[model samples]
Every structure is written in structure tokens, then in C-alpha cells.
Target: MIDSPKPTSLKAVMETLNAQEAAKPSSGLTSKEKRARTVARLVLVQALYQMELTGTGVETVIREFSDHRFEGDLEGEKLADADEAFFGEGARAIVKEQATIDRLITDRLAAGWRIERLDTTVRAILRSGAWELKFRPDVAVEVVINEYVEIARAFYGETEARFVNGALDGIAKDTRG
Candidate 1:
């Protein structure tokens, strides 16, 4: 399990991302690595959003994103190769097994609400949590759920945090089963 970064506030993560975004080409990281990290973050965010919005297969979305869309964002020969590789692999795996993940989430839902009807932020958090649980199980499930719940609290609110926690706990159980 990827040891979750010590519990930093969501504001810190976003600030870090923003700093990375604003970093000059001359900064410590090679432009390529910087670009890659940016791309990876973007893809991660997009995948979570898309899964909630469309419930589409992850493979299809990733293929389309990689083959066509990903290229347009880069200008020269120097592209974010590492970011592309990491993001592509991670997104593909998560999307490929999304249905199974969603099923796990559905199984854990409270009475009266279905997975489809949940708010997009809640759903996105679940997708991220499921991805971590399934693909990055080396990272403790509690860490994954907690980090995502923080993300939910940052972007949404306490209500969404409860929903995210419930969904992730359900997913962890289902993945274990």
C-alpha cells in the first residue's frame, strides 16, 4: 500500500498542485516531469468527473484521451512522457474495472439512495477510493477513504464526506469479498 502522505489539509494539496502549475521551466523539476505531473493530476480529476457524469467504460475514455486529446496539450518534442505513462496506466486500470467498483459501492449504500443518484462529487470520490483500493491496495484502505473524504470535504462539504465514507467502506468490503 502506498503510504498515504501524512494527513495534510486539502488546501495544502491544492496549493501544492497550484505551485507545481505555476513553477517556471527553469525550476528544479525538468519541464517534462512537471508537465507529466500536471497531466496526471488533470487526467485523474477528469476520470473521476467523467465516471460520475457518464458511467462510461474507463478504457474507452482513456484511449480516446491518450490517442487524440493528450497530444494537443503539448507543444514541442518535450512532452510529459512520465506523467502520460503513469496517468494512462492508472486511469485505464480504474476505468476498466469501474463497473466492479461501482457494484461494490452500490452494495454499501444506505437505504433509499442508489449509486447513480448520488451527487457528482460523492461519486467522484468513490471512484478515486475504489481505484486506490483495487489497484493500490498497498496503501491502506483507511488512508484512501480518508484522503478522498478530505477531498470531498474540501470541494463539497460534510454531507458529501459522509456519503464518500459510506461508499468507500462499501467498496472496501466488496473488493475484499
Candidate 2:
């Protein structure tokens, strides 16, 4: 008889990730408060997707997520707690500035692939990264690129991560330089 392990649910996967993050020796990330900003970036990508898929206003979705999703247990599982300010910044500012971001993304793409044709999750990663590169000069460019590349890996395989690296690298070079 053969027994196979059940597929890991997103919740269990996330819990494992949180534990792993807790275990990482605090070198560059000197405090949990600093780490929360990275958590907010990940959550911002997810919230951006939610806003696009649903017709929810940015403020409404942010309110809903802030009130009920960030710090509470929803559907019997603990929710991802992230920095509230960064979440609002990405959801509202990123979506609002999407047209400009898309233009930058479009310039970097190959001849046939339009930005709209890209996968939503991938697009979200790029948009958030682009937003940071163009707007958040306080964070270093390499830091912004690497963070989104990791986020891409969390959702996709090596191919997608490479793709993200290329696009973000191109944008970062053009914009940051």
C-alpha cells in the first residue's frame, strides 16, 4: 500500500514560512518591526489582486482588511499581520499609479507580450516593485528587486522568479539610474 502526504494548504504553507522567518538570524533585519514591512509588501501584493478581481474600492478594501483581516483569525486560521501603513500605501498608491507603472513595464517587455497579458500575480509583484523603485527612494533598488523576486518565488517556480528578476532589473536600471 502506498500512502501520500496531503497537499499543503496555503495556510499551512504560510505558517511554515512565518516560522522560517522567525528563525532567520537577525542580520540585516535587526528587528521584528523591520520585518513587518516585508510582511506588508507580501500582503500588499495579495490585496492588490483582491482589489482588481473584486470591484471593491481601494479604501473599502483597505478598511475591510485593516479592520478584520490583518490581526484576527478569519475562517478559523490566524491572518497575516502586516504593517498597516505600508499596506494602504501599496493598495491605494500602486493602483492609482498603475498607468505610469504599466508604461514602464510595457517598455521593458518583449515585442509580443503586453503588460495586460501577463499573469495577475506576476503583474502585482512587478507593480509593487516598480512603485517602490519610482516612489520610495528611501529603500535601496537592490533591496526592492530582491524582495519582489522572493515574493515571486513564493508564488511560482524558478522560471517565474527569473522572469520577475529580468523585468524588475530592467525597470530598476532604467528608473533608478
Candidate 3:
């Protein structure tokens, strides 16, 4: 693939994702909206991580968490809605196409490492990568892979970033073809 600007810094990318969430009704987002989206992404990432670990339904986790933890603040309310749509769609799409995603990963592995044996964080990263690749085709594949790889590095470590990058690169190639 052609080289591109190193995907924006993690903070910047997360900010953009949050801005998109907050600016759903419009194209431009104010600083307040951007902050709300960042907060919302944090909550959604936690919820998605929980669901991945526990196998709970995404809606169930979202509802329970929002009702208990996010009921009061105005930003929370806005974020809850945006997070519900953004993460809900992503998690469900990952579930729906898991077989295809797994097959694609399996075909690309260097050997010994299996999708099933992946750590939760790596699995989550892979799921997010697959979701972006399949559903958000408007995003360039390199950006999708690079963004998630950065996420993996931040949340997990440099070692995990390599794994995420390799797996996603393989998945991107398979899906793009």
C-alpha cells in the first residue's frame, strides 16, 4: 500500500471519532461536543471490552451501564445515544460476520497463533478492524488498520500493536480483494 501520513495521533483520532459522534446532527462540532464524544468513546470502549470478556449482549450492557453510571450529565446523555449507535453497530456487525472475519484471519496467520487463542484486547482490536473494513468502506483500509494498531499500542503495548497491524493488514488485503 502507498505510504500515508502516519494516521493521526491517538488523541487526535479519538477526538475526531468523538467529534463525529457529537456532530451527527451537523457537520461541525464545537469543543463541548468534541469533549462529549471523547467521554462517550471511553464509556463505549469499556462497555465493548466488557461484552467481549463476558459475552453479554451489547444492548444489555449499554442499557445497564447507562442507567447506572451515566444517568445524570447532559454530555453523558448525548454520549449514551451516540455510543449506543456507534459501538452497537460495530459490535453487532462483528458478531454477524465473525465467521468470515475469523476465516480471513486464519488464512492470513503466520502459523501457531489462532484467532480463538487471541487475547481479549487483540480480539477486540481485530473485531474493530473488521468492522471498519467491512462496514465503513469509506475509510481507507490503511487508516482503519493504522488507527486500531495505535489503539492497541495505547491500550495494550507495542508488542500488541505489531500483532494487530499484521492481522489487520492480512484482513484488509482479504476483504479488499
Candidate 4:
């Protein structure tokens, strides 16, 4: 169990998270909308990975996802419907500005650690996180870092999540500050 104000079972944890989200007064987004966006980000990273591995074009990948992918389970877990418009827009924008996004990520990576040297999943995470940092000014830097770090945790352990956090934090400093 994670450190928290009170120890919680896995089931209660969702309620706790929902309560916490409800307490955030600054957010105009409803919890369902926020969940959909989070799902969208997860799906977006997968789409990016697929495009890289299969040499698929952006439109084709986006269309494929919209038509056949988003409504179903992901990795055995039930997922909320992804924000399809957000997913498509983000994928297109990222591909369009990928060179710049790659450069931003490459610069944040440690010396001797090239963007291409990273695991493909990590690369996808960094690319999408970097794109959001540079392009999505409406999202707070902390939210971007936290969301991507959570995505990293889904695929890896604490160490990779920390690496993603540091990399995105660096990118945020350069792009958001």
C-alpha cells in the first residue's frame, strides 16, 4: 500500500482519489472528463509506440484507434472511453512537431543517453510529455509531470517513473518557465 493519510484497500482508493479530485476547485473539468483525458494520454502513448514500430502514418493510426481501439479494454484493464478528439489532435500535433519535440527531449536526456537509446515505451512517454509541455499551455507543469509519471509507473517501476519525472521536469523548466 502507498503512503497516505489512511491505509486504504484498492477499492476504497478509487473513492479516495475521487474525493480528492472533487476538492480541487480550480479545475473546470468534471471528474469523468478528466478520467477520459487520462485514458486518452495512455492510449496516445500506445499509438505513438505503434506508429514508431510499424511505420504507420499518423492519420491511419488515429483512425484505426478511433474506429477499433478506444472503447475496449487495455492490457486487461477496463478503460474509460478516451477523448478521441484530444487523442487525434495530440497525435497529429506531436507528429507534425516531432522534430522539435525530439530535440527538446534529446536535450533533457543525460549526456550519453540519446533519445533513440531510450526504451521505445520510454521514448513515447517522453515525446508525448514533451509535446504537452511545449504545446499545451492550459495544463499545469505539475499535472503533466504527474500524469506522465503515472503512465510510466503503469509500464515500469519507480526508477523509470523517476527518470520520466526528471526528464519532463527539465523539459517543463525550459518550455514552461
**Model 3 Cα shift for residue 126 (angstroms):** 0.6
Which residue pairs show collisions in model 4?
A: none
lDDT of 3 at 148: 71
lDDT (C-alpha, whole model) for all candidates: 0.60, 0.73, 0.61, 0.77
Angstrom error of the Cα, residue 171, model 2: value is 0.9
User: lDDT per residue, candidate 4, 8-49, as tens digits?
Assistant: 122232343445556666566878877667778778888888
lDDT of 1 at 9: 47
Q: For model 1, how does the per-residue alpha-carbon lDDT over 1-177 read when each residue is reduced to its tens digit?
A: 111122224435444444634653344556555545544544465565775467666676667666765665322322234366666666776667878777777777777778888766566567667877877666566556655665666566677778777777777777755
Deviating ranges (above 4 Å) for candidate 3 = 1-45, 65-83
* Clash count in backbone of candidate 2: 0
- Candidate 2: stretches off by over 4 Å: 1-30, 73-80
Prediction 4 global C-alpha lDDT: 0.77
lDDT by residue (11-33, candidate 3, tens digit) is: 55565455444545442546564
In angstroms, give how far residue 34 of model 2 lies from its true place: 2.4
User: How does candidate 2 score on lDDT?
Assistant: 0.73
- For candidate 1, report its TM-score: 0.58
**Which candidate ranks first by TM-score, i.e. highest?**
4
Give me the candidate number with maximum lDDT.
Answer: 4
Candidate with the larger TM-score of 2 and 3: 2
Q: Could you tally the backbone clashes for each prediction? A: 4, 0, 0, 0
